[model samples]
Target chain A: MDLDILINSLRNYDGITRKNFIRGATQILDETYNIGGRTALGFGDDASALDIGNDTLLLMAADGMWGRLIEGDPRWAGYCSVLVNVNDIAAMGGVPMGMTNVISVNKEDICNEIMLGIKEGVEKFGIPMVGGHIHPDTPYTALDVSITGIVGKDDVITSCGAKIGDSVIIGMDLDGRQHPKFPLNWDTTSHKTPELVQSQITVMNSIAKKHLLTAGKDISNPGILGTLGMLLEASGVGAIVELEKIPRNKKVSWDEWLKVYPGSGFVLTSKEENVKECIEMLQEVNITSQVAGIITEDKKLNLRHDNQEKVVFDFNHDIIMGIKEERS
Target chain B: MDLDILINSLRNYDGITRKNFIRGATQILDETYNIGGRTALGFGDDASALDIGNDTLLLMAADGMWGRLIEGDPRWAGYCSVLVNVNDIAAMGGVPMGMTNVISVNKEDICNEIMLGIKEGVEKFGIPMVGGHIHPDTPYTALDVSITGIVGKDDVITSCGAKIGDSVIIGMDLDGRQHPKFPLNWDTTSHKTPELVQSQITVMNSIAKKHLLTAGKDISNPGILGTLGMLLEASGVGAIVELEKIPRNKKVSWDEWLKVYPGSGFVLTSKEENVKECIEMLQEVNITSQVAGIITEDKKLNLRHDNQEKVVFDFNHDIIMGIKEERS
Candidate 1:
C-alpha cells in the first residue's frame, strides 16, 4: 500500500472533516459548559458526564443519522442510531440505561420504517428506547437519538487520560461483512446472537473496572485511525502507529478498512504490562486486539507502514474536533 | 366566549392532533419497553423513569423544536428546546441534571444563532448543554435535545396517578408577555432572574417530596385544556375544570389563552387537604396557582365557564396521544 496516498485520503475524509465544525458551534456554550458545576466531563468525549454523587457518573450522548443514510435507507439509519449511541456509552465503560429520540418526517412510511429499525436495535442491544418526540409534518426526514448511561465515578474511562508511554491498541470485531447498501458500515452485531453482542458491550465495563486501560474511544464515522487521532488530540499527546499492526478483515483492503465504521470497535491505551490482559479480555468477547502504536509527546500522529513514515494529523496545525479536554 | 366555539377550537387544535402519532411509533417497542427490566416508568409520562437503585430513579426525556419555530426564529427555537426539556424533568419532580442535543443544519448562520440561544437557555436554567452531535450539511434544520435527571423513587410525580376526588390545580407563571414573533409562546423565564426561574423548577421537587400533587404534567404545545385532557387520559380518569378558575394573564383573551404554550405552566392534581400547601409553594416562586377543577371517575374532560359546562375531550371517542399509562 502507498502510505502517502492512504494518509491523504484519510486526512481529507468527510467524516473527519465534518467534525471540525463542532468546536465552533459548541464554543458558544464555552462559558457555561459546566453551568451547574455538576459536569464531570464535557464537550470532547464520546459522552458528556455528570457527577451524580454516590460514586456514579451519568453519561449522556447524542447521534444523528447522516442525511444521505436517511435518504438511501431509513431502516438502516434508524438501526445504526441505536448502535452508535450505545457504543458511545459503552466506550466510556458505562451501562446504558435508556434512550430517547426525536424524528421529523413528512412521510408516514419512512417514519414507520425508521421506528422498526430502532426497535430491532433496541431488542438486539437490550437497551430500551423508552420515549421520544415526533414531528409528523416536517419538510424533510431526520432522526436524532440521545442516550443515558451510568458508570462508577472511578471506573469511567475518558479520552483525555492517555499517557505518553501507553500502548495504543486497536480492538475491532472482524467477523462481519460490509453492509449491502452502505459499504463503509462494518456489520458485526446484526448477524451475531444478542447474548454475544451484549457481552461485547459489557466487556468494556470489566476492563474499566480493572483499570486495564488508561484511555479509550469507540471507532465511529472517523474510522479507526481518525478516531485515534481524536483520542490523541483530547489527551494532549501524540502517537506513532504501525499501520501494519492494525487488525484487518483480510477480505477488505487496508485503505478501505481503516475508514470503515465498525459495529464493534475501539481505540484504547494501556500500560505495557496491562496490554496482554487487555487484548485477552477483548478476545474473549470476539474483539480482535493488537498493540498498534505507542503514545508520544510530539503532538503529531505519525504512521509507519512497510518502512514508509508519514504524518496523518499534526495537532500543532491540524484539528479533528478542535475541542480540548474538559475536566470537572 | 362561546362554549361550543371554544370546545371545538381546542378539540381540533393541531397541537393535540399531532400527538396522536406518538403512540403508534412508541408502541412498536411494546414487547421490549423494559428490556433490561429497570424501567420504573416508560412511555406516556413527561419523562421515562429507570429504577437506578439507591432510592433514585433516572428520569430521561427528549423534545424537538417545532419545525415552524425553527424556520421562523432559530434562536428562539434553540432557547425553547432547553426550556421544554427542563420542564419535562421538573414536571416529574426531578433535579435537572444535564442535556445533550443533535442538530442538523444546512445553514451556518442559523446553526450559530441556535447555539447562541442554547447558550442563553443553559445559563438561564443552570443546566449545562454537555455534548451533542452536529450534522453541518442537511437538507433542513432541526434541533432535538434530551435530558437526564434524578428523582427520589417515592417522590417522583407521574401523570398516571391522579385519583378520583382529587383537586385539579392549574399552576402558571402569568407575569410575562407573548413573544413578538411567536404570539402563542408566553415568554416567562426569559425576563425573570436566573434565581427566580430556577426556583420555579425547584418548587416541583418540593411539592413531590411533600406528596402534595397526585399527578402532574407540564403544559406544552397542547395548551391548558388540551394538556389537562392528556393527563386525564393517562390517569384513566376525568376532570371538570372551571375556565375562569384557571389562572390566566388578564391581558390575553380567553380563547387565545387556552391555546397558548406558556414558558412555565403545569396541570396538576392533588388531594383537597394538600391544595393549600401546593398553591402556596408555587405562589412563592411567582407561579400563580388555583384549584380549577376536580378529578372524576368518568374518563371525560368537562370544561365549565359562566355556569355552562361542555365536554372538551370524550376519551371514548377522542384520544390525545392514545397511550395508556405504563406503570412500573
Candidate 2:
C-alpha cells in the first residue's frame, strides 16, 4: 500500500473535513460553555458532562442525521439516530437513560417508517424514547436526537486524558456486513440478539468502573484514524499507529475499512499494564481488540505501514475540530 | 368581540393545529415509551422524567424551531429555542442545568447570527449550552434544542395531577410588547435584567418544593386558551375559564393576547386553599397571576366572556395533541 496516498485520502476525507465548522461555532460561545462552573467536561468530548452533585455527572449529547441519509432511507436514518446517540453516552462510559428527538418530515408514511425504526432501536438498547417534537409540514426531512446519561463523577472517561506513553487500542465488532444502501455503515447489531447487543453497551461502563482506559471515543463518521486524531487534538498529544496492527473485517480493503463506522467500535488509550485485561474483557463481548499504536508527545498523527511512515495530521497546521481541552 | 369568531380562530390557529401530528408519531413508539421501567413520566408532560435513583428524577424535553421563523429571523429562532427548552424544564419545576443543540444551516452569516442569539440566551438564563452538533452543508436552516434538568422525585408537578375542583391559574409577565418580527411572540425577557429573569425560573422550583400546585405547564405556541386546552386534555379532564379574568397586557387585543407565545407564561392548577400563596409567590418575581378558571370532570374546555359561553375544545371531539396521561 502507498502510505502517502492512504494518508492523503483520510486527511481530505469529507467525514473528517466536515468537522471544521464546529470550532468556529463553538468559539462564538466559548466564554459561556461553563458559565455555571458545573461543566466537568465540554465541547471537545463525545458527550459533555455537568457536575450535578451527589458524586455523579450528567452526560448529554446530540446528533443530527445527514439530510442525504434521511432522504435515501428514513428508517435507517431514524435507527442510526438512536444508535449514534446511545454510542455517544456509551463512549463516555455512561449508561444512557433516555432520548428525545425532533423529526421533521412531510409524508406520513415516511414518519411511520422512521418511528418503527426508532422503536426497534429503543427495544434493542433497552433505553426509552420518552418524548419528542414533530414538524409534519416541513419542506425537508430531518431527524435530530439528544440523549442523557449518568456516570460516577470520578469514573467518567474524557477525551483529553491520554498520556504520552499510553498504548492505543482499537476495538470493533467484526461480525458484520457493510450496509448495502450506506456503504460506510458496518451493520453488526441489527441481527444480533438483544442480550448480546446490550452486553456490548454495558461493557464500556464496566471498563469505566474498573478505570481500565485513560481516554476513549467511539469511531464515528470521521472513521478510526480521524477519530483518534480528534482525541489527540483534544489531549494536546499525538499517536504513532502501525496500520497493519489495526483490527479489520477481511471483506473490506484497508482504505474502506478505515472509514467504515462500525455498530460497536472505539479508539481507546490505556496504560500498558491495563491493555491485556482491557482487551480480554472486550473480547468476552465479541469485540475484536488489539493494541495498534502508542501515544506520543509530538503533536502529529503518524501512520506506519510497509516500512514507510506518513503524517496524516500535523496538529500544528492541520485542523480537525481544532478544540484542545481547556480545563485544568 | 364575537365569542364564536374568537373561538373558531384559535381552534384553527397554526400553533395549536400543528400539534395534531404529535399523536400519530408518538403512538407508533407507544410500547417502548417506558421501556426500562425507569420512566416516571413520559408523553403528555412538559418534560419526561426518569427516576435516576437518590430520590431525584432526570427531566428532559426537546423542541424544533418553526421553519418560517428560522427563515424570517434566525436570531430570534435561536433565542426562542433556548427560551422554549428552558421553560419546558421550569414548567416541570426543575432546575435547568444544561442544554445541547443541533443546528443545520447553509449560510455562514445566518449561522453566526443564530450562535450569537444562543450566546445571548445562555448568558440571560445563566444556563450553559455545553455541547452540540452542526450540519453546515444542509439545504435548509433548522435548530433543535434539548435540555436536562433535575427535580426531587416527590416534588415533581405533573400535568396529570390536577384535581376536579382545583382552581386554574394563568401566570404571565404582562409588562412586555409583541416582537416586531413575530407578532405572536410576547417579548418579555429580552429587555429584563438577568437577575429578575432567572428569578422567574427558580420561583417554580420554590413552588414545587412547597408542593403548592397539583399540576402545571408552560404556555407555548398555543396561546392561553389553547394551552389550557392541552393541559386539560393531558389531565384527562376539562376546564371552565373566564376570559376576562386571565391576566393580559392591555395593548394586545383579546384575540391577539390569547395566541401570543409569551417569554414567561404558565398555566397552573392549585387547590383553592393554596391559590393565595401560589399567586403571592408568582407575584414576587413580577409574573402577574390570577385565578382564571376551575378544573372539571367533563371533557370540555369552555370559555366564558361577557356572560356568553363557548366551547373552545370539547376533548371528546377535538384532538390537540390527543395524548392523555396514561400513567396510573
Candidate 3:
C-alpha cells in the first residue's frame, strides 16, 4: 500500500475534511459559548456542559443528519438522529435522559417514516424524544435532535480529561454490517436486543462512575482515528496508536472501516492500571476493546501499522475543532 | 371592535392556527416521548422537563421562527430565536443557560445577518450559543433553536399546575412597537438594556424559588389570550379573563396588543394569597402584571369585555393544540 495515497485519501474524505469547518465555526462562537460563566465544557466535546446547582451538570448536544442521507432514507435519518444524540450523552458519562427534535419536510410519507424510525430508536434506547416543533411543510427535508442529560459534577468523563501515560483503548461492536443505503454507516443496534443495546449504554455510565477512564468520546463521523484525534485535541494530549490493534471486522477495508459511523463504539483513555478492567467491562457487554496506544505529551498523533509510522494529526499545526477543552 | 371579525381573524391567523397541526404531529410520537420514563414533562409545555438524578431536572425546548419573518428580516428572526428560547427556560422558572440552533439558508447575506443578530442576542441575554448544525444550502430559510437549563426538582413551574380559584396574572413589557417587517411582533427588547432584559428572566426564577405561582408559561404564537387558553387546558382548568383588564400598550389597540408577541411576556396562575407577591415581583422587572382573570373548574375559556363575555375556546368542544398535555 502506498502511504502517500492512503494519507491523501484520508485527508480528502468528506468525513475527515468536514471537521475543518467545525474548527472555524467554533472559534467564532467561543466567547458566547461560555456566556454567563456557566458553560463548564463548550466545543470539542460530544456535548456542551453547563453547571447547575448542587454539583450537578447538564450535558446538552445537537446533531443534524446530512441532507443526502435524509433524502435517501428518512427513516434511517430519524433513527440515526436518536442514535447520535444518545451517544453524545453517553460520551459525557451522563445518564441519557431526554431529547427534542425539529424536523422539516415536504412529504408526509417521509415524515411518517422518520417518525417510525425515531419511535423504534426511543423504545430500544429507552430514552424519550420528549417535545419538539415540527415544520410540516418545507421545500426540503431535514431532521435535528438535541438531548439533555445529567451527571454528577465530579463523576463526569470529559473528552478533555486524558492525561499523558494514559492507555488509549477502543471499544466497538464488530458484529455489524454496512447499511445498504449508507455504506459509511455500520448498523449494529438494528440486530441487537434492546437489553443488549441498553447494556452498552449503561456500561459507559458504570465506567464513568467507577472513575476508570481519564478521557473518552463516542466514535462518530470521522471514525476511530479521527475521533481519537478530537479527544487528544480536547485533552491537549497526544497518542501513538497501533493501527493493527484497533478492533476490526476484517470484512471491510481499513480505510472504509475507519470511517463508518458505528452503532456503538467509543474511544477511551484510562490509567495504565485501569485499562484491563475497562476493557473487561466493555467485553462483558459484547464490545471488543483493546489497548490501541499510549497517550503522550508530544502534541502529535502517531499511527503505526506494520511497524510503519505516520503522523495522522500534528497538533502543532493541525486543528480538528480548534477548541482546547482541557480544563486544568 | 367587531367581535366576530376579530375572533375570525385570530382563528385564521397563521400564528394561532399553525399550532392546530401540532396535535396530529405530536400524537404520532407521544408513545416515544416517555420511552425511557425519564421525561417528567413533555409536549405542550414551554419546555420538556427530564428527571435527571439527585432531584434535579433538565428543561429542554425548541422554537422555529416563522418563515415569513426570516424572509422579511433575517436579523429579527435570529434575535427572536434567542429571545424565545430564553423565555422557554424562564417560563419553567429555570435559569436561561445556553442555546443551540439549526439554521437553513442559501444566501450569504441572510446567514451573516442572522449570525450578527444571534451575536447581539447572545450578548444581550448573557447566554451562550454553544453548538448547532447549519444547513448551508436549502430551498428556503428557516431557524430552529433549542435550549437546555437546570431547574430544581421542586422549583419547576409547569403550565399543568393551575387549580381552581387561582388568580390568573398576565405579565408583559407594555412598552414596545410593532415591528415594521412583522407587524404582529411586539418588539420590546430591541431598545432595552441587556441588564434589563436579563432581569426580566430572573424575576420568574424568584417566583418559582419562593413557591408562589401555581403555573406559568411564556406567551407565544397564539398571542396572550390564546396562550392563556393552552395553559388552562394543560392544567385541566379553565378561566374567565377580563379583556379590559389584560395589560396592553395604549398606542396599540387592545386586539393588536393581545396578539403581538411581546419581547418579554408571561401568563401565570397563583392562589389568591400569592397574587400580590407575584405581581410585585414581575413589576420590579418592568413587566406590568395584574389579576386579569380567575381559574375555574369548567373547561371553557371565557373572555369578557364591556360585560359582553364571549366564549373563545370551550375545551369541552374546541381544541387549540388538541393534545390535552395531561402529564400523568
Candidate 4:
C-alpha cells in the first residue's frame, strides 16, 4: 500500500473533517465547562464526567444521528443511536445505565420502526429507554439520544491520560459484516447473542477497576486513526502506528477497514507492562486485540507501512477538535 | 371571560396537542422500559428515575426545542432548553448536577447565538453544561438537551403519587412579562438574580425532604390546566380547579396566561395540612403560590370560572400522552 495515499485519505475523510465544528462550538463554553468545579473531565472525552459524590462520577454523553442515515433507514439509525451511546459510556469504563431520546419524525410508520429498533437495542444492551420528548409535527426526521452512566471517581478512564512510551492497543469485534446501506458501519452486535454483546460492555468496567489502561476511546465516525488522533490531541501527545500491525477484517481493504465504525471497537493506551493482561482480557470477550503502536512525546501521528512512513496528523498544524484537556 | 372559548383554546393549543405522540412512542418500549428492574419511575414523569444505590436515584430527562421557536428566536430557544431540563430535575425534587446537549444548526451566526444563550443559562442556573455533540451541517436548526440529577430515592416527588382529596397548588413567578418573540413564553428568570432563580429550584428539594407534597410536576409547554391534565392522567386521578384562584400576572389575559410556559413554575399536590407550609416555602423564593384545586377520583380535569364549569380533559376518552404511570 502507498503510505502517502492512505495517510491522505484518512486525513481528508469526511468522518475526520466533520469534527472541525467541535472546537469552535466548545470554545464558546470554555469558561464554564468547569464552572461548578465538579467537572472531573469535560469537552474532550467520549463522555463528560462530573463528580457526583460517594466516590462516584456521573458520566454523560449525547449523539445526533446523521440526517442521511435517518432518511435512508430510520430503524438502523435508531439502533445505531443506542449502540453509539452505550459504546461511549463503555469507552469511559462506566456501567451503562439508562438513555433518553428526542425523536422528531412526522410519519407514524417511520416512528414505529424507529421505536422498534430502539426496543431491540435496549433488549440487547440491557439498558432502559426511560423517558424522552417527541416532536410530532416536525418537517423532518431526526433522532438525538443522550446517556448517563456512573464510574468510580478514581477509576474513570479519560482521553487525556496517555503517557509517552505507552503501548497503543486497538481492540475490535471482528466477527461482523459491513452494513450494506451504510458501508462505514461494521455490523457485529446485531448477529451476536445478548450475553456476548453485554459482556463486551462489562469488560471495560473490569479493566477500569483493575487500572489496566492509561487512556481509551471508542472508535466512532472518525475511523480508527482519526479517533486515535483525537485522543492524541486531547492528551497533547502523539504516536507512530504500524499499519500492518493493526487488527482488521480480511474482507475489507485497509482503507475501508480503517474507516468502518465497528459495533464494538476501542483505541486504548497502557504502559508496556500492562498491555499483555489488557489484550488477554479483551480477547476473552471476543475482541481482537493487538499492540499496534507506541505513544510518543512529539505531537504527531505517523503511519508506517511497506517500510515507508507518512505523517497523518501533525498536531502543530492539523486540527481535529483542537481543544486540549484542561486540568484544574 | 368566556369560559368555553378559553377552554377550547387551551384544548387545541399546539403545545398540549403536540404531546399526543408520546403515548404511541412510549408504548413501543412498554415491555422494556424497566428492563433491568432499576427503573423507579419511567414514563409519565418530568424525569425518569433509576435506583443508583446509596439510597439515591439517578434522574434523567430530555427536551427538544420547538422548531418554530428556534426559527423565530434561536437565543431564547437555547436559553429555554436549559431552563426546561433543569426544571425537569427540580420537579422531581433533585439537585441539578449537569447537562449535555445535541445542537444541529447550519449557520455559524445562529450557532454562536444559541451557544451564548446556553452559556447565559448555565451561569444563571449555576449548573454546568459539561459536554455536548454539535451537528454543524444539518438543514434544520434543532437543540435537544438532557440533564442528570441526584435525589434521595425516598424523597422523590412523582406525578403518580397524587391521592384523592389532595390539594392542588399552582406556583409561578408572576413578576415577568411575555417574551417578545414567543408570546407563550413567560419570561421569569431572565431578569431575576441568580440567587432567587436558583432558590426556586432548591426549595423543591426541601419540600421533598420534608415530605410536604404527595406529588409534583413542573408546568411546561402545556401551561397550567394542560399540565395538570397530564399529572392527573399519570396519577389515574382527576381534579377540580377554580380558575380565579390560580395566581397569574394581570398583564396576560386568562386565555394567554393559561398557556404561557413560565421559566419557573410547578403544579403540586399536597395533603390539606401541608398546603400552608408548602405555599409559605414557595413564597419565600419569590414564586407566587396558592391552592387552586382539589384532586378527585373521577378521571376528568374540570375548570370552574365565574361559576361556569368546563371539562378540559376527560381522561376516560381524551388522551394526552395516554401512557399512565405503571407502578411495579
Candidates, DockQ: 0.89, 0.90, 0.62, 0.89
Better of 2 and 4 by DockQ: 2
Compute each candidate's TM-score over C-alphas: 0.99, 0.99, 0.94, 0.99
Evaluate all candidate structures by whole-model CA lDDT and list the values in order: 0.93, 0.92, 0.85, 0.93
Worst 10 residues of 2 chain B by lDDT: B319-328
- lDDT ranking, high to low: 1, 4, 2, 3
Candidate 1: stretches off by over 4 Å: none
Query: Ten residues in a row with the worst lDDT in model 2 chain A?
Result: A319-328
| lDDT digits (tens) for residues A1-328 of candidate 3 | 6555565676667776667656544465666777888778877788888887678777888887888888898888889999999998898888887889888876778888888888888888888888888776667788889888878888888999888999999999999999999988999999889999999988888998999999999999888888998899888989999888999999988888888899999999999899999999999999999999999999998888776888888999987666688452
The TM-score that candidate 4 achieves is 0.99
lDDT of 3 at A18: 64
Q: After superposition, how far is residue A166 of candidate 2 from its true place, in Å?
A: 0.3
Q: Provide the TM-score of chain A alone for each candidate, in the order shown.
A: 0.99, 0.99, 0.97, 0.99
lDDT of 4 by residue, B1-328 (tens): 8888898999999889998989888888988999888899998899999998899999999999999988998888888899999999999999999999999999999999899999999989988888889999999999999999999989998999899999999999999989988888999999999889999999999999999999999999999988899999999999999999999999889999999999999999999999999999999999999999999999999999887988989999999888678655
- Model 3 residue runs over 4 Å out of place are B105-112, B135-140
Model 1 C-alpha lDDT per residue in residues A101-146, reported as the tens digit of each score: 9999888889999999999999999999988899998888899999
**Evaluation by lDDT, superior candidate among 2 and 3:** 2
**Can you tell me which runs of candidate 4 are displaced by over 4 Å?**
none
